[model samples]
Target chain A: MISKSVAQFVRSLHQKKYRQQEGCFLVEGAKSVQEVLSSTFEVDLLLTTDAFYKENADGADRQRCRIETATAEELTRVGTLESNNAALAVVRMRANVPLLRAPDAWVLVLDDIRDPGNLGTILRIADWYGIDTILCSETTADVYNPKVISASKGSFTRVNWWYGDLTGVLNQANAPVYGAFLDGDDVHQSPFNAAGGYIVMGNEANGIGPNITPFVTQRITIPRYGDAESLNVGIATAVILDNLRRVQG
Target chain B: MISKSVAQFVRSLHQKKYRQQEGCFLVEGAKSVQEVLSSTFEVDLLLTTDAFYKENADGADRQRCRIETATAEELTRVGTLESNNAALAVVRMRANVPLLRAPDAWVLVLDDIRDPGNLGTILRIADWYGIDTILCSETTADVYNPKVISASKGSFTRVNWWYGDLTGVLNQANAPVYGAFLDGDDVHQSPFNAAGGYIVMGNEANGIGPNITPFVTQRITIPRYGDAESLNVGIATAVILDNLRRVQG
Candidate 1:
């Protein structure tokens, strides 16, 4: 059973301020919890239902991560998920943002991606396409937002994110800076060299902001052939990334 | 100004059962409202703030839909959206399911897409790729759900959907069925004939259900290069469609 103080401490992590202040954020569900355990992230606390640990005994033993028991009701209180997932954890948030100068490959630079799910999906897309860095403008939703953490399916561990001025970072990106827009060049037929660069995705309602738009070297778009006015930002990101990766003479 | 009874009526549409019972659904924001008004879907009412109407008079005129003026406060009370978008409309649900024939053009068959955003993205994807017909399983999220409607960004008008037994519909799609799965053939190298067949997407947690699994004639997946476990379903759909469209050679 979770004590009142423990529950209070866990719930506080829901806020961006609280998560930053403590240098810890929460991840829930068996998949994410297990991924964190196996990855480089340090687990502050490991809370799981007894039934969950028993079923995956071998994986649990190899993890050697801390184990704490919770009844079904206790699991219900701590988990940020809509339903009571099998496990939840308080993992230390990486404190520093790595510099963007050394880009061996692509990094995603998001300009105010407000939706947590979209931001997370972008991170996952970056992971799938071998892009290892994510630089978020201050206006972007907090990376540690639980919904993003869950949507990423633990790709957050592999990708490094820095929250700062997008203009400053674009200046640092020596290679081409590509932006997704309505009238941009067709991504399907565009020439995207794979040396290294930043792929900028913009706000859901608005495309890339005027502040960073000037720095963009290539304006590209996933061409729409049907009647929908716009594709969801996440889908557009994947379409663009997938196409960019497959570009070959 | 909305009367007490009118406010109560508007608020009720927030629920799926209520939207179903009244045979009407809500659309918000300038673009979505305009799209619904312009489409064959009937508009029961259009609610807006005064400022919105003045600024968007041209769009409103083009739509020529009915109108109602309300304070922003009144909109919040009746709206399902968290954002205070300029307009909202109650559109008559087009319960008309298009004829269930094997589409000669590409069609997306969703076995059990649960996320409103994913379903909406899929709807938008269908629009981007010109796949107009989407057949949903009974378990999929209602396309009329405000999130799904909002996420489609007005693509809902172009895409026709039917919620029924998925396999039955797949039976009609005798040409070919491409199912997305982890163990499927690499979509990059696969020959996905565009001779009007079905491309099936699975549930978020579980892929195609057992009932629908057997109906898939070909299983194809977007090959992943990173440690990320999988791609988001909507992203998978876009990637697959984009590749298939490219691999048409």
Candidate 2:
């Protein structure tokens, strides 16, 4: 049985304030915990059921953490996921890394993406399209939020995320910036530069912010055939990336 | 001010059983309620704040429905959305219309898409791409669910949804059946028939079920460039539709 204080401590990480204060965040469920174990982050706490421990405890990284045995019910009580049956881990947050210049690789730049689920889905789409890094405006949703982590599935492990000034990064990096806009060049017909660059997705309700617009070298749009107002930012990301890759390939 | 009994009755529609029994469902927030007013579905009740009623009551469709003045606090208490400052409508559910054969236009076929949000997003994507009809397995989430309605935004008004046997519809469809599979031909390379047909999307965890596999005349895939396991079903749908539109256009 887990102690009440420990359970309380684990639950506290659910809030952004507590997570920032502690410099650690919760990763729950079997898939996420496994991804955390395999990732570069240091595990501060690893609470798992006997079955999960028996199956995955053999890894060397498991020995580096403060591991504890707990029941599935105990995990569900402490975890953000309602139906977590296996494990929950508190992984240490990495320091904010500066954006790197990689002109040959497509990077996703997000501006004020408010929804955690949308941010997470974009991360997963970035991972799927081999876009290794994501640069987010300071106003964007916190990447370490449990909902964002949960929505990303295991793709969070592979995608590098950084929240900083989008304009600063776009200006510093020697790459063309392509923004998703309402009345822009048709994505299907727009000729993408063979050398990769940046694709900036904007806020859900608002398109690209004015601060970031001047840095954009090209404004591209996903052609719409019907009357729906706009595509969800996450869906738009995937659709745009698919087109980007098709053009590059 | 709304009556207490009426508020309680409206709240009960949150559950599927109550909605089915009453043949009605809730549409919350301003955009959705506006769509419900304009649609063919009869509105049983329209609960609106004074501001919304003052601004939009001039519309001709408002005369056709029972319009009630309600406060924002009363709406927040009775509705599913936390910040519903505008309106909520109790809409009568339409009878399930059988799937129509749309050989010349795209019809999205869903197999056990369980999440209301995914189903809703798919409906929005369908509306965006001008795919008028969505055919779903009976196992799919209810189209009238409040979460689905909210996620679809106003696109639910434009899209026709029917839940029935997938095999029967595919067999009867006079056009080619295209199924999204990981092992299928690359969608970018695969030539889409200019005459539109059916595009079958699968469930969250599983791909297209075995029973539905035999009917797929063409197997297509979105090429992945990175290590992410899979795309969310909704994102996958929009990407596929974008490609299909690109090919057809």
Candidate 3:
């Protein structure tokens, strides 16, 4: 049986304030926990059921962290996921080191993406399109938030993110900045001749902010054939990346 | 103020069984409630705050439904949304009449899409891409579920959906069937020459089921350039539709 204080500690990481105070965040579910154990991130503590421990003991044994056996009920009680039959891990947060855009490679820039789920989904999209680096505005949802971690499914391990002022990065950028806008040049027809650059996505309710808009070298739009007021920020990101890859090929 | 009995009745629609029993579902927030009031769908009851009523009194007046003035707190207390400051409406569920495929138009087919948010996001994607009709398996999340309605962001009013046996529909379908598979033809290079057909999407964990597999005339994939295992079903759907529209143009 797990102690009450330990459970309380794990549960505290669910909120951003506690996660910041502790400098660690919770990674719940079997897949995410396994990814974190295998990743470079330091695991502070791991709570796992007997079945999960048995199945992934090799990976768990390799990690330099405290491992405790717990029931599925205990995991569900202390975790943010609706049901977690496998494991939950307390992982040390990485320093927000600036992510440099590699030579001839694409990067994603997020501006004030407030929803945790949207932020996580964007991370997954970035992973899918092979965009390894992400730059986020300070107002964007905390990447360590449990909701963001849960929604990312294990993509959080693959994508590197830095939360800072977007203006400073955009202003210093040497590559072209393409921002998603409603009335900009059609993405399908836009000549993406540049080897690699930055693809900037904006807030859910608001498009790109004024501060970031001027730094945008080009404004791109996914032409709408129907009447949706707008596409979800995550969906728009995927479409933009897909089109960008298609043109580069 | 909404009566206790009426509040209880509206809350009952949150569940599928009661929604089925009463032949009604709830649409929350100002935008969705307004969309329901203006749509062809019948509205049974509408609960609105004074601000929303004042701003949208004309739209509310146009509906042939019971309109009761309630405080924002009462609306939030009675509704599923976390903070509903505007309105909520009890809307009659549409009859599950099979949606006829329009000539030279693509239709979406969903197989066991269990998540309401994914289903709703797909609906919005369809609305954005101009794919108006969707055919879903019976196991798919209820289209009238509040989560689906909220995630759809009023796209439910514009798009049409029918849920039933997938095999029966696919077996009788004359149009080409394209199923999203991990190892299918690269969507970037695939020749989407068909005038109009079906784009089939599967469950979160499972691809298209065995029953629906045989009907797929063309197997397509969104080529992954990175190490992420798979795309979310909704994201995949948007990517496919965007490519389809690009090629068709």
Candidate 4:
């Protein structure tokens, strides 16, 4: 049975203030929860449907994962998303923004990416393409945001995210920093071409924020022949990564 | 000033039945509304914040857009999406999904692709890369879904979309049909493949649906060294397009 105080506490996580106060954020769905439990992330609590707990609890024996069987309705009530998931967990946040070990390599830097789904999707892309580290600016959505966590599928477990000033970081970087722009040299051909550099993607509605623009060695654009005003950030990154990597790959 | 009945009518388009009955769908925001006004797609109605209409009405004259000015409150009452915009347009549905006119070259087929944003983003990718036609299986979400329209960023203006039995379509194609599957041959090693073929992408959660499997000549898989379970459909498509296209300016 979920106590009223527990219910209130779980509901409070929707706001950033409450999440910081608790030092935790919510994760939902069986797949994501299982992925987190298997990783280095510390699962403080795992509330799941009794059927779900019975189905997959043994092999995923994480002593830190304290499983509490609950009804679907109860899980739904605490869920931060529109969909009711089979499992839910409150995991401690990874507060450290570790220095990217190999900074010269292809590191994706997100500037003010506010949408959790977009942020999460971006992480999954990074994982798929074998990008080891991602640096997100301060205004980018929190990595622990529920929507971001869900959209990331399970990629967040392996992907490290941090809140830092992208402008400052890129300015001091040893290699090229490519910022996507509306009118830049074709990404297919640019001199900032090194084995690895920072590929900076900006916010959804806005291009590269002013703070980071000056630091970019080349403002690159995906060759667009059609009438689209701009590609979705996730799509644009994929296009750039595919093109840039093909030349080097 | 928007009337009560009109607001209700506009808001009703959120429901599939209402959209079907009216033979129209909603497109909102400055970019979306502007795209519909500029495109050949017939605009049944237009509602915008007076401030926007006054500033941007000149362009509407070129497209012969029928403009209706509404208060923020009225737009709020009528808008289907969470974020209200400066403008909204009711575009008459493109009821016909025509067979591929240029099926001789590379084509895209979506087998139950569900996400609106993914579908829209895919359409935009198709437009940018010069994939003239995309065939959608019956289960795929409607291309006109407002979320899809908004996410496309106006790429829907060019790409031709059709819904039908994907198997039948594949059977008719003269070239080898390719399907992207986890079990398929590594896409990287696959040599100068067939020129004209239907490239099938599957649903969001599930890979390719069963019906379309038997008809494919080749299965392609993206090599992944990271922990991500799957790539976003839009990303996967862009990656494939980059690989297949004759890469030169």
Candidate 5:
């Protein structure tokens, strides 16, 4: 049984300001909660159904976090998901540490990508392409947003992200910076960096910001065959990464 | 000024049953309303701001639909979009007629794409790849769903779709049927049909339904380099279409 205060605390994390004040965010549903239990991130508290608790008690105990058994209805009421039958974890956020680019490995950079769903999907796409590190401009959606966490499908645990001023990082870049643009070298024909580099994606409505555009060493376009105005940024990312992997292989 | 009855009628189209019973769907936002006005699809009614009505009065006149000048707030109140400042169109639903495959052009088949947003994004992707025809399973989300219309941008105007039994269509397919699967020929290395054929995408959670699996002449897989359990249906669709276009070229 969950106390009134604990339930309210969990509910409060739904808002960004509360999450920031608490330095914790929610990971809902069975799969994501299970994933967070195994990851290195600290879980402050976990509220779960009896069945979930029984199946995952060992993992939950290892996290050294307080665990409370609650009804599925109770779990759903406190969580962001429509119907979370299994679990929800209030996990602590990681520090805004700088991530170094690994040798011969691609790094994804986000410039003011404001949508939470898009950000989360991009994280999952990055995980699919084995791009582990991501750099985000401060204007990008908060990594700790529950929508982002849910959409990532637990990929948030595997991928590392750093949010800061993108211009400073791009200006001092030692490797090539590739940006997605409407009029640029065709991604299918353009040769990518053999040693890997920074791949920057911009805002949903606007392309890359003016501050970062000058730092791009290469501009790439996904050729359009039909009359659609533009591709969804997450879809564009996946296509670009798929092509990148194909050429690298 | 919009009347109360008209507002009630527009709001009712948000549900599928109402849309079917009335044989009309809502097209919200400035761009989509404009596109639907210009498309062959008939517009039954149009609610627009005075500013929008002035800008596109000729096109609105050409649609031969009843035009009501309403405030942006009124449009927003009755529409699915949070802020529809320009226009909202009540469009007549097209007949569920069969679409013939254009020779040497690919056709997309969806088994049970349940998410309205995913369905809309797929339509956009199909438009981007020049795949104009789509066949949908009965269980698929209704194409006229407001979320689908909004997510599709304006691609819903360009792409043609038919909803019916997958079994009948696949049994009579004249060309190769390519189904996306987990274990199959690597899409990158696989030789595609020189002449375009049917490319089938399945349900979001379930890859391909058993009913449609047997009809697939060739099973294709997008090779995953990292740890994502599966790609989102829309992302998968884009990736597959991109590869198909690249190889065909």
Candidate 6:
């Protein structure tokens, strides 16, 4: 049972400003809620349907988090995901930890990716490709946005994201830097090292920003077979990672 | 110069029912509106700002279509794209022409792509990869949806889409059938013919439907390097097409 004040607080967390002030963000839908329950993210509150509660009540973390049963209608009203009938969790935002670049694993650097959905999808792609760390420019979409959280499909729990000056971070990184371009060396034939490196994906409408350009040691292009002015950034990231994995494997 | 009746009609096209009833769909934003003007699609109406009118009024097709001046506010209110400030064109739905499966060109078969954005992104991927025709199951999202058009980023004009039974179309196609699966042959090492074939992409959550399963002669999988449970359907399509092009090129 949700009190009026608790309901208002949960609803407030939907907006980034409120989330920043409260130091927490929402994780909607069953998959993501379950993922956070098992991850290092500390859950402040869990509003869910009785069925979801029944299914997860035995988990060890249940003792540490506050749980409340919510009707489907209440969940829809409070959560950004209208179709979510399972749960929504208020997760405390951990301090921004510096991304640790593993010598043998690739790290994704995002340059001003604005769309929440694209950012979220990119996280999932990173998670799938075993790339653990993502460095986002300060202008990139907030990862805590409900849209991003929903789109990441629980992969957010596994991937570490740090937001700051991308140019500064990439410049200091230990590995080789590869940037995607329209007229660069074809990714299929490009020299890719099995020792992982940094792959920088640019903004949706704009390619890599001007500041980050000088840091790219190698320029790569995904050859286009037909006339699409460009590929969507999220799709491009996944395609690049897939190619990267092919070479590494 | 926008008429009350015209505004009501344009607003109604946002719904699939009205689009189907009117036998037309909207081409919103400057890029898509321009593409439709140059394409074979018959434009029934064009609502635009004065700047757009001055820019495009010289086109030969201008004589064949009705043109009206609309404020940015009006365009935002009537069109599905809220950010659109340039123009919107109401294009007649051309009859579903039989897919011209060029024997040496690949074709995409969508099993049950339900998201309009995913479907649109897939179309752009198809357009980029030179896959000219797409056979979609009746359950697939309508190609004429504004979200699909917006996401396609003008690729809608280059591609031909047909809605029908998946089983019937695959059984009738002259090319070999390839299905994407988790346990199928690794796409990296899979034998791909330079001659065009039908590549089947399944539903977002359900993968391929059972009814369409029997027609796939070859099963191919994109090997996972990370633990992401599955790639989004749109990402999967682009990745598969990229690999196919690698072999075909």
Question: Top lDDT: which candidate number?
Answer: 5
Question: How would you class the docking of model 1?
Answer: medium
TM-score of every prediction relative to native: 0.92, 0.97, 0.98, 0.93, 0.99, 0.97
Q: A136, model 4: CA deviation in Å?
A: 1.5
Decide which is better by TM-score, 2 or 4.
2
Give the runs in model 6 whose Cα sits over 4 Å from its true position: A60-63, B60-63
Which consecutive 10 residues in model 4 chain A have the weakest lDDT in total? A58-67
Report the lDDT tens digits of candidate 3 across residue range A1-249. Answer: 789999999988989899999999999999999998999888999999999999989888889689999999999999988999999999999998998989888889999999999999988888888889999999999999999998888999999999999999989999899998877888889546467889899999988898999999988999999988999999999999999888775
Off by over 4 Å in 4: A183-185, A188-195, A247-249, B56-66, B188-194, B246-249
Once fitted onto the true fold, the runs of candidate 2 whose alpha carbons sit more than 4 angstroms away are A60-63, B60-63
DockQ of every predicted complex: 0.62, 0.89, 0.83, 0.59, 0.83, 0.88
User: How far does residue B248 in candidate 1 sit from its true spot (Å)?
Assistant: 5.0
lDDT of 3 at A79: 91
Q: Native contact fraction of candidate 2? A: 0.88
Candidate 4 residue lDDT tens string, A72-187: 78888878766664778888888766566384468889999988888988988888777868998889998878888999998898888768877677777888788889888776
Docking class of 6: high
Positional deviation of B181 in candidate 3, in angstroms? 0.4
Interface RMSD for each predicted structure: 2.4, 0.7, 0.9, 2.2, 0.8, 0.6
lDDT (Cα, tens digit) per residue for candidate 1, span B160-196: 8988877767776668888888888887675587675
| Clash pairs (backbone) in predicted model 2 | none
Query: Which 10 consecutive positions of candidate 5 chain B have the poorest summed lDDT?
Result: B182-191
**Candidate 5 structure quality by residue, lDDT tens digits, A1-249:** 889999999999999999999999999999999999999989999998999999999889999999899999999988889999999999999989999898898999999999999999999999998899999999999999999999999999999999999988988888999999988788888459899999999999997999999999999999998999999999999999999998885
Residue-wise lDDT of candidate 2 within A1-249, one digit each (tens)? 778988999999999999999999988888878887888778898898889988888642454887888999999988888788898888899888986847588888999999999988988898899888888899999999999999999788888888888777877868788999888888999557778888889889988999999998988998999889989999999988999888885
A best-first ranking of the candidates according to their DockQ comes to: 2, 6, 3, 5, 1, 4
Better of 1 and 4 by lDDT: 1
Writing each residue's lDDT as its tens digit, candidate 3 over B176-198 gives: 99999877888888547567888
- Cα displacement (angstroms), candidate 2, residue B119, comes to 0.6
- Report how closely model 4 matches the true complex, as a DockQ value: 0.59
Clash pairs, candidate 3, are none
Report how far residue A213 has shifted in candidate 2, in Å.
1.7
State the DockQ, from 0 to 1, for candidate 6: 0.88
